[model samples]
Target: MHRPACSSYLHQLRRRLLLLVLLSAISAAQGHADEFIYNSFSGADLSMDNQASVIDGLLRLSEGTDTKGHAFHTFPLDFSNNPIISSNTSSVPSFSTTFVFAIISDYDDLSTDGLAFVLSSTNKLFSSSAAQYLGLLNSETMGNESNHLLAIELDTIKNQEFGDIDSNHIGIDMNSLISNASKGAGYYTPDGEFKNLKLNSGEPMQVWVDYDSERTILNVTMAPLPSTKPNRPLLSIPYDLSSVLPNTRAYVGFSAAAGGIPTMHCILGWSFMNGEAAALNYSDLPLKSIQQLRAGRHTYKTIIIVCAVLLPTLGIAMIVSATIVKVRMMNRLSKSRTTDIEWEREYGPPSFTYKDLLAATSGFNDKMLLGRGGFGSVFRGVLHHSKQTVAIKRVSPESKQGMKEFMAEILILGHLRHRNLVQLIGYCRHKQQLLLVYDYMPNGSLDSYLHTQDHSTTNICWAQRFCIIKGIASGLFYLHEDWEQVVIHRDIKTSNVLLDGEMNARLGDFGLARSHDHGADAHTTRVAGTWGYIAPELARLGKATKATDVFAFGVLTMEVACGRRPIWVDGANGEPVALSDWVLAAWRGGSITDAVDTRLDDYVEEDIELVLKLGLLCSHPSPNARPCMRRVMQYLRSDAPLPADLQPDNLLRIGVSQELRMMSVERPMSCPATTITDLSKGR
Candidate 1:
């Protein structure tokens, strides 16, 4: 009987052990089902579209100009059935994803387009377009709510239509090409300072995206490869995934496109899971893929080997060549040193060597030319010492009076420091050549976007235009009242206003700027400014003051709001009509809001009316009647209400009628006797 009992106990023990092992196996299987990892794409199960291919264990999304590519997982994943939470809730389950990527371009400081990490309801993006659309949507499908798509874009081009902040930035999108929220591509340091990152640097970087269902918050964090992830996220947006997607099942992948310039977008590794994603090992990633795309590493090694073999054989020849070259360089250096010393004695700004500027601008090649202005032509260059990109303005060599304007720019911009003011890096003088260096603005002048005839390029939206207006006002306020000396920007127009990499308005072209001590009258003897931007009193007085700058700003305000030049030829009868006069007529006709840009799809009517009315107020003919920059800021920021007496009839009584009559008769008004014949010629 005892033996029979022992046998039964042994059988029960064996059954219990088997059950435990089976449960552990199921748990492991579920974990494996919930996550996916790709250390290499050589033999990975993926669905690829045009231009997307896996070669040598690297995933290349786009490799040439005017190309679009898509790569998605072969199987869809259900996000609703998260192991950490129940599936009964309406909110989508939380998830995390991490990836490593690199963008390689042929040029160092320029790139055409970028890439995106996408999550879509459908596996294929058949209706996508290339270029600024990022291979995610087309004109017809963009902004469609029924698309059920979400994307995190790493953009390298500033597309005004979509309201991109700058060329290099990261943005979050939901069912539309326009990002709902965006930030410049950068990461925060441990001390909380921001450091900008160049997306097309051809160096591997890691990105982490985590969504918390409980808080409905999505955090995006990025850092260079081999470094631990930063604690602070680059962007944290509050949104619900359910609102962007019809269901919890979706395909995850990457999409990229190139525009007119050659660029290659690549992905090295990726991992995704319902919970935290598995950490990526930098050692295991294909970091050399970017270098290979640029020029094969083996090719570099071969060059190094050939140099090693030839160095000893050519030693005597190289010694003689070096001595001869050194003597010539010494002579050139002596002349440059003499010229620099003379400039330093006369000017307060720092100076750059002519040789350095030449190398920076590639000997001022035509391809590096940015634009020609009334005073000079600007070139994009990168300094060798700091690798900092700059804009070098080469003044016209034929102008005998160019020295005066060049000195004015140096004296004024050398000491001024403001976010809205263009920063003067230094100056270079070589014989008749006069070059002024400034921080490079990648987006170029504001007029290009506002007045371009190409309808193919999207117009800047109302929001961006309004922001630019406010920014210019703030800069003017600083110049007039906040600085040590009162500054009068003799020329304040759209062409003089440049946009930086982040699309912020920066007042440039200080060649015509003038400054005076507090409470001192401007002693300028010649009037200088664009046609319609010049104040009526300036032509008579031949003097520029803070009020004259205000007048120009007013015209600029109207130009930006109307999306027309300050002086444009009427399409109907070929008569030049001033922007301010046209806007004033609209106000008198009780259709002031109609003066807003028609290209704008949406706008706040109240804001539009306020801007129009304020512009007219500032453009008042009498200098004493025009509001100062301080008051103008108040009006723009809503800190103070506009004067109630500021009606069209009241304005007409205060010389608005005379001003309109003069503008109509003169068409493009003439400036007081000055050097520039047609102020708009070079622009």
Candidate 2:
């Protein structure tokens, strides 16, 4: 034993002597055809930004316990002396880098956001804000091809906005802030065994990144301490770095961000080469302090080693115990004594924890609120798992009726699927707070554009307005007849119609909807629905039927056509007149074109007359007089001719008398004879 120990000491001394000679020669060649940089942080030249500092001989990019902030540190890579590889350059070069890092958080019970290794044209820190943006790129630079940047992110928190694969993973980003691809964090052992690693476990890990310009390929490798480098890289991606990097050199660094949960990202050591392939001597690395830190974690290491050895022996028993415990816990959680838990189980959509929402919505800040309604207030948030932008509705906690309505909406929309309907993504319940998640609609409700007096920012055009009408009709048709059961939408108004990214309408607010069997006499005593849009029969008899929904749809159609509310208060006389009554009187007097909104300068006059006439037919006093939703949809699409009986003579019958002459002089007959000319002028 004594002879072996002596031999080992001599070998270590000789290796150190050889490393010193090799490093001297490497330093001489670094300024010319190649470049190399290495930092131990104990006493090295490292340029840290204002948000970063050197703590305990390690570079700390973010505060030890700070949350909702960003920090960055850059290396002094002078482009004038050492240029980076680029497509515009005469010869694109290859490079490799190795880094040792450790991530830790004050709060261990909850995971935290993490850091990234970046190469960028600008040396600025915190180019983006905190949270999912990761201090690398902001909204302006995201997905911008001109922003020369490349990053390898070791993320510990799953932010949906960044498209994180998991809570702990490795991702590759180019130009854009969001990762193009990512994989679960792990390492391969010498025996080719795979071991999952957690970046936020407060453990140190070593990483290697190599770029080959010839093959336009990039490779990333990782390993836990006390282990040698793997024979093969864990992740090898084909990337044309020359296209992304600028002709000028770039600044290399690390960036970290935190939101509700903070993390301390530290770089214990780093080494990089920018030119030709040079042998890496891991033995020459300064790792005495790192070794000491690992020694302190012997207890955890021993436990992990023992577990790895006994995994096969105890696998079946552990699986059985885990499954039994999981089932019992799920049952208990889902069957709790509250109605919320029952709704959660019955709906069975993904359930987000209250903490997750708090972070996503920035502690439910007022700025995050999208809008408010009678039942609840809606807020916008970015989900951590997918980086998806979502709208969250929080029901009023004190409203017992609102709670019932909330449950009713979930039950109605959970199983329904249609492009013209809002999607129910998930929900959250904590103590007294109840929240529902939905896909965000960029354009707000239809009421905003038609009623708001601000036409300057109004996004709806004449053609889009017409399409919205047809889209709403399609949704109502589905609710009333296309689905498995008949659904009566007690409230059908402009406010209930939401616009998607493409400005197509999606009928929402199903709290007042009721499902029943077709051909069954279904009646409700509940007095629900908006005032003017409510059918006359529903108001007097307090009954909800398919015809009642059609009546409301008719009122909505007039509102869209005239760009007015269901009830209009005349400015000239402080008297309120129902919009349907005013339009019907205009049609009777041969002045119906005057009721059309003058704001719409570009529209087919014939289509306007048809919609006005249809509105009057559907809003007739008798529910049976209204056309079915299917017939209304067909009329809007011009798939079928209007019923002769429902078509009032004043609207269709031409007498060729003084009345016809006055109608033509007022609105002008720009229909069949002038279709091509009018459409061309409008376009």
Q: Whose TM-score is greatest here?
A: 1
lDDT of 1 by residue, 532-611 (tens): 78788886667899999999998889888888777655668755567777787888888998787888768898888889
Clash counts per candidate, in order, are 0, 7
Lowest summed lDDT over 10 consecutive residues: which window, candidate 1? Answer: 673-682
The 0-to-1 C-alpha lDDT of every candidate, in the order given, reads 0.81, 0.69
How does residue 41 of candidate 2 score in lDDT? Answer: 60
Off by over 4 Å in 2: 1-341, 455-459, 571-573, 647-683
* Global lDDT of model 1: 0.81
**Most accurate candidate by lDDT:** 1
Q: Residue 10 of candidate 2: its Cα lDDT?
A: 100
RMSD of each: 13.5, 16.2
On residues 1-683, what C-alpha lDDT tens digit does candidate 2 reach at each position?
59999999999999999999999898775564334444556555555663566655666667432222322233444444435445543233577777777776534433446778887777674457555566677756789887788889888765534556667888888987568777788888788888898787667788888887667788888988646677777788887775777555677777876544335677777767775334334454445544554454455545544554454345544556567666565445433433443443355423478888888899989999998765778999998855778888899998786687677777776545566888666576777778877778889788877876674344566788889888888888878877667888787888888988889898887877888888786667865787567665565567889888888888888888888777645578644457776786677777687887767878788788778878887776677677898898889889987777654453323221223234445654322233322311110
